[model samples]
Target: MKAIWGQKMAKVPISWMVLLFMCFWAYMADAEYVKYKDSKQPLNVRIKDLMSQMTLEEKIGQMVQIDRQFASAKVMKKYFIGSIFSGGGSAPAQRASAETWINMVNDFQKGSLSTRLGIPMIYGIDAVHGHNTVYKATIFPHYVGLGATRDPTLVKRIGAATALEVRATGISYVFAPCIAVCRDPRWGRCYESYSEDPKIVQAMTEIISGLQEKKSQLVLNTMWAMVEQPKVSMRTTR
Candidate 1:
C-alpha cells in the first residue's frame, strides 16, 4: 500500500510540472518584441526599433520594387519585395473589376505579411490623370488643361476625386499630378505639366494634399512626383 501511495504522489508532481510548463509556454507566446507595431510609440522610436531588427537583405528588399506581372505570394515571400507597381496597361485580367483588384493586392500582401518581420508591400500605379488603369474609372483632364483654369481649388477637388477612385481599386500609391513645370512645348510629356508658369505648377501641388486627405482618413496614401527636366531629345516627338 505504501508503494502504491508513493506512485500516486509522484504522478501529482508530474501533473504540476505539466501545468507549470503550459503557463510558461503561454507567457512566451504572448511576449511581443515589435515595438514598431505600437502606434502610440514616438515615430523616431518605432523607426529605430524596426531598423535595428532588419537584416541587410531585408533593407535591400525594402528598396526594390517589381512589376505586378512578376509578383506572386511565393515570389514576394522569397524575395521580400518591398513595392509592387502596375506599369502602363498592367492589370490582373482584362477589364478587371474592383473586387478583382482588391483580391490581387490582398494576395500579394499576404505573402509580404507572412515574412519574418511581416512588412507589408506597397502597391503603386501610374494613376496620373485618374485611376485610369481601372475599367469604368473617371478619367480627368491632364495637368495642362487643369492649369488653364488657374483655379487650384478646382484642381484640388479633382485630385480628391481621383484619390477616392484610386482607393476603390485597393491601390496605396499614386505616380501622379506630374508636378513638372514644362518650359518647352516640345517635351513629349508636356501634357503632364500643369503649365509653363512655375507659379501655376506650385499652386497645383494642392493635388498632393488632396490625395493624402481622404474623407475617412482611412488610406495610407503616398504619391510619387514625376518631375521632368527639359528633355532635349523629346523635341523630336511632336
Candidate 2:
C-alpha cells in the first residue's frame, strides 16, 4: 500500500510540472507579440513596434486606397487594405440611408481588422456638401454658394454639421472644401470650388476647424485644392 501511494504522489508532480510549463510558454508568447496592442505605450512606440512586425507586402497594402465599389471585405482582408473610399455617386445603394452606409463600412472595417496585425481601416467619402451621398442627410450649399455668403462663421457651422452627418455613416475622412481658384466659368467642377479669388479660398479653410471633432478626431488632411488655368491668357501689366 505504501509503495502504491508513493507512485501516485510522484505522478502528481509530473502533471503539475507539465501544466506550469504550458502556462509559462503562453505568457512568454503573449509578452513577445502583444506589445503594440498595449494602449499605455506612446503612439510612436506602438507604431514602431507594429511596423517592425509588418512584412513588405503588409506595408504596401497600407499605402493603397481602394474604392468601395471595386473592393469587398474579403479583398480588404486578403490584401490588408489601409483605406477605403466612396467616390462621387458611389453608395451601397442608390441614395443609401445613413444606417445602411454605417453597416456597409463596418463590415469592411471588420475585414481589415481581421488581418494578422489587426490594423483598422480608414473610410473616406465625398461628403463635400453635408453627406450628399446619403439619403436624408442635410444637403448644405455648394462651396460656390457658401463663398457668396462670405460668412466664415456660417461656413464653419456647415462644416460641423457635415462632420456629424458623415460620422453617422461610419466614415472618418472627407474629400471636401475644394479650394480651387476657378479661372474660368467653363470648368465643369467650378461649383465645387469656394471661389476664383485666392483670398476667399484661403479664408474658407477655417471650415476645417469646425469639421474636426475632439473625441473622434476625424482626419481633415484629404482636402483637394487644385489650380486650373483656362485657355485664355492674361496680359501682365509691367
Candidate 3:
C-alpha cells in the first residue's frame, strides 16, 4: 500500500508541473502590449512624446534605409534600421510569392517591434509602373505612355491602384515618380520618366494624391530622392 502511495505521490509533481506550465502559457497568451492614444492628441505632441521615450541610437537608426539583402533581421535589430527596402532586382527568397513577400517583410517588422521602442519598421519597394519589379504583380504602362494618354485623372487612378497592391504586399512605402528629364533617347530607363519636360514631372507628383495618406498625414519615408543614373550606364549610353 505504501509503495502504491509513493507511486501516486510521484505523479503529483508531474501533474503540478503541467498545470503550472499551462497557467504561464495562458498568462503570455493574454498579454497585451499595444495601446491606442486619444485621437484628440496633437500629432506633433504625440510624436514628440514617443520620440522622447526613444534613445539617441534609436533616433539615428530611423534615418538609415538599407537594402534587405545587406541588412539581416539580426543586424537590423542591433542597428534598429528605421526602414528596409528591396531595391529593384532584389527578391525575398527563391520561389517567392506575394504571400512570401508579406511574410518576409512582416518578420523583419516583428523584429523591429520587439525592440524597446516598439517602433514599427517601414518597408519600401520600387513599385514604379504598377509594381513591375515584383514577380506576378500587375504591370502597368510606364509614365511616358501614360503621359501620352493625357489623362491626369487616369494616371492618379493607376497610382491609387498601385498603392493598394503595394500595401497588400505588406509594404507601405514606394519609390516612384522618377522625375528626370530623359532628353537622350538612348537612356535605358528613359521610359520611367514621364517626359523630357519638367512640367510633366510636376504634374505626375499628383501620384501623391493617388497614394492614400493616413488622415492627411504622409507616413514616414514617403519620398527618397534618387540621384542620377549610374556612371557606367551613363558612359554606355553616351
Candidate 4:
C-alpha cells in the first residue's frame, strides 16, 4: 500500500516574508513620488526632488552651457545639460524665423525631458538691444540712448517691452541690462554698458529688475559690486 503524501512544502521564515513585503511597498511608494513631482509643486520642493535623482556628473554638466547649434543630442542624453544658450547670431538651419527659433528650442527641451529625471531645460539668449540679432525682432534704443533721456521710468518701460518681445520668441532667459562702468570707449562691448559711473551702473539694476520677472534665477554676470555705507550717529551716547 502506498502511503499518502501528507504535505510537500518548503519552509519560509515569517520574518523574511514580512521583510520582503515591506521592501516592495516602500519601492512602490518611492516610484509614486518620482512620477508625480513637477514644476507645479513649490519651487524649493521641486528642485529638491530633482536633485535627489541626479548624479554627480549631471550636476557638474548643468554648470556649463553650450550653444544650441553645437550641442550634441547624444552628449546631452549622457551629460544631463541643464541649460542651452543661443548667443548672438546662432540659429538652426533651413528656418531662422521667430517661430522656427521657438520650435528648435522646444525640440531641444523635449530631448532634455527624456532623461530619467524629466527636468525641463532653460534656454538663454543675448536679448540685448531688443533681441537685436534675430530677424523681425524689435530694435530698441541701446542703453546709451535710454540713459541720455534720463527717464528712469521710461527705461523701465523699455525693459518691460523688451521682456515681452523676448517672451514672444519663446525664450525665458536674457543676457541683458549690460551694467558696466566704462572707463574707456575702446572696449568692443562698451556700447552695451550704460554708464561710466558706478552709481549709474548700480541704477541699471532697476532695468534688470524690469527685464526679468520677479523671483527668477536668470541673471548673468560680468561684474561685482561692494557697498560700504558709513553710518553716522548724531545723537549723544547715553
Highest-TM-score candidate: 2
* Superposed model 2: Cα runs more than 4 Å off: 1-29, 215-217, 224-238
Q: Model 4: residues >4 Å from true position, as ranges?
A: 1-30, 35-49, 72-75, 93-95, 213-238
Per-candidate total of colliding backbone pairs = 0, 0, 0, 0
Greater-TM-score candidate between 3 and 4? 4
Give the top-scoring candidate (lDDT): 2
Looking at candidate 2, the ten consecutive residues that score lowest on lDDT are 229-238
Q: lDDT at 30 for candidate 4?
A: 79
Comparing 1 and 3 on TM-score, the stronger one: 1
Instruction: Output the better candidate (1/3) by lDDT.
Output: 1
Per-prediction TM-score: 0.80, 0.80, 0.68, 0.71
Candidate 3: the clashing residue pairs are: none
What would you estimate as the lDDT of candidate 4?
Answer: 0.66
Clashing pairs in 2: none
- Candidate 1 residue runs with Cα over 4 Å from true position: 1-26, 216-238
lDDT of 3 by residue, 1-238 (tens): 9999999888787778899999999888667422323357787776877777778899999888888887666767888889887777788776578898888887888788777766778887887788766777778898788767766777777778777778777777777656566788897877877777766655665665676555321232232123232211111111
lDDT of 3: 0.70
Q: What's the lDDT for residue 19 in model 2? A: 97
On the 0 to 100 scale, the lDDT of residue 90 in model 4 is 78
Candidate 3 at 17: error in angstroms?
32
Task: Write the residue-wise lDDT of candidate 1 on 123-196 in tens digits.
Answer: 98888777888888899888788889898898877778888888888887766656666787787888878888
Task: In model 3, state the lDDT of residue 131.
Answer: 72
